[model samples]
Target: LVVLLVRLHLTGFFWGDCSLSNTLFRRSAGEFAAYLVDAETGELHGVLSYGQRAYDLDLLSTNVFGELLDLQAGELLDADVDPATLVARIGERYDDLWRALTDVEEFSVDEMWRIEQRIERLNRLGFDVDELDIVTDWDGATVRIQPKVVEAEHHARRLQGLTGLDVEESQARRLLNDLDAFAAAHGLQAEDPMIIAHRWVTDVYEPLRAMIPDPLRGIVEPAEMYHDILVHRWFLSERAGDEVDFFDAARSYVESILPARAATVSAAETSGPDELSAVSPSDDDPSFD
Candidate 1:
């Protein structure tokens, strides 16, 4: 979340009225992919001053805390989660990340360690430094360095190259790990990558995707289905006291887990002006926000 805020701030987006309801989350390798859904009050500047960035983060933290409190009241949030502490942590982490990205450090020419350290830190945080702006003293004995441009999505590109699959960063990492496992199990590790990828698409990815019924296809993307099945496989294996075969695991997932989700994606596509809202259950109140 610290990385998300800093990266968005770097790219000139100021989400003026940030809130939990304005974001959509997708499961990703035990984490989540958070997409900004409602930008109604957002503004884009060429650059933001520290004060402006702080203001945005403050709004986000406050709104998120309130949302957490509401969920806790409804018994939806974990009992141990504290809203105030969570919000405070966000502010503290945001400050640290902001400093890392924008602070300037002066180091002597002999201290090349400083140069590599900055790049390594950003890369570890899933950012790529495209270029550096370095200024040396008149005698070239000291230097100041700054990352000119930092971009995210390192894993996404690697997965795309290997399998032509476009997925979120965390999902891509999960899938790539699976692909490697498949190659090793089948003795395809030394074979040409394209051939290995083709077999994976045919023997692994495609079969998993094809298992979804046509009526349920829109509920989740192919890559997401694959990831979920992988997770489902683990639980199924755990219960059986041994590893579950991929197809059996996938069948169990579809039978037990996919039904409740069928309406979700289709509902999102439907809420457009031309579409009618579904009838609400009689016991449910309609006026609540």
Candidate 2:
């Protein structure tokens, strides 16, 4: 959690309202990565002061604690989980992440490898720095550096670049990794990414989309359904050590998975004004004969 918060700060973002719901967790190369959502209310500060950073941290902790309590009330939390201990640990995690992203060191001018090293750290944290904000003394004897405009959640963009499929941030990351694997298997190059993605959509995505039953079409968006199918395919592939054919996978998904998803949209059409009040009773009184 600390690692994620510090990363966001380093990227010049202040998650104005942070909480577990705004974040999604996914496994990447055996470690969990956090993706921040609900950034509509967030602020982008040119530079974050220590006090400002601490306040953001405090809000994170408070929000997380409150969320956990709410979960417990709903009987969603594990009985063994301790709220106080968990909240404290979250703070500790934030501090550690902060240090990794910002701790500076002095190096001789002869050693220029530090610059590369800094970029590598951010890359490992799933970020690509578009521009670095660096400061040098009047003599140019020493360098001070920070990332000026870092692009966060790169996986989402890459996935869309390849597949033209927009997805939720975390799911996009998962799908992008799969696309890379698919590219490698087909001996595809960076220049040929779109071609490969098209092949994937034709050979994989479309078949799954076609399998959606007409009655249950409103369960989720098609792109999201496609994303989930890819996830399901990955798990199945890992279990069996064989690639599952897209159509077969789609059949299984539509049968077993799609049915379980509750449709949020109602089938009944709403009555328009013309339909609701189409006819009115006459107010004329009948004369007695």
User: For model 1, which pairs clash?
Assistant: none
Q: What is the per-residue lDDT of model 2 for residues 92-204, given as tens digits with 9 covering 90 to 100?
A: 88776566555565555666688888887866665677877666768877877776566655666777787887665566665666667777877776647779889877776
Model 2 Cα shift for residue 103 (angstroms) = 3.9
lDDT (tens digit, per residue) of candidate 1 on 1-289 = 5566677799998878777788878766657777888889888999988788889898989899999999888876778899998889998998887777767778999997989999888766666778888999999999999887878776677678877888888888788788889999999999998888889888989888888998877667778777777887887788789999989988877876665445544655677422323422122321110
Q: How does model 1 score by TM-score?
A: 0.76
**Candidate 2 TM-score versus the reference:** 0.66
Q: Choose the strongest candidate by TM-score.
A: 1
- Against the hidden reference, what TM-scores do the models get? 0.76, 0.66
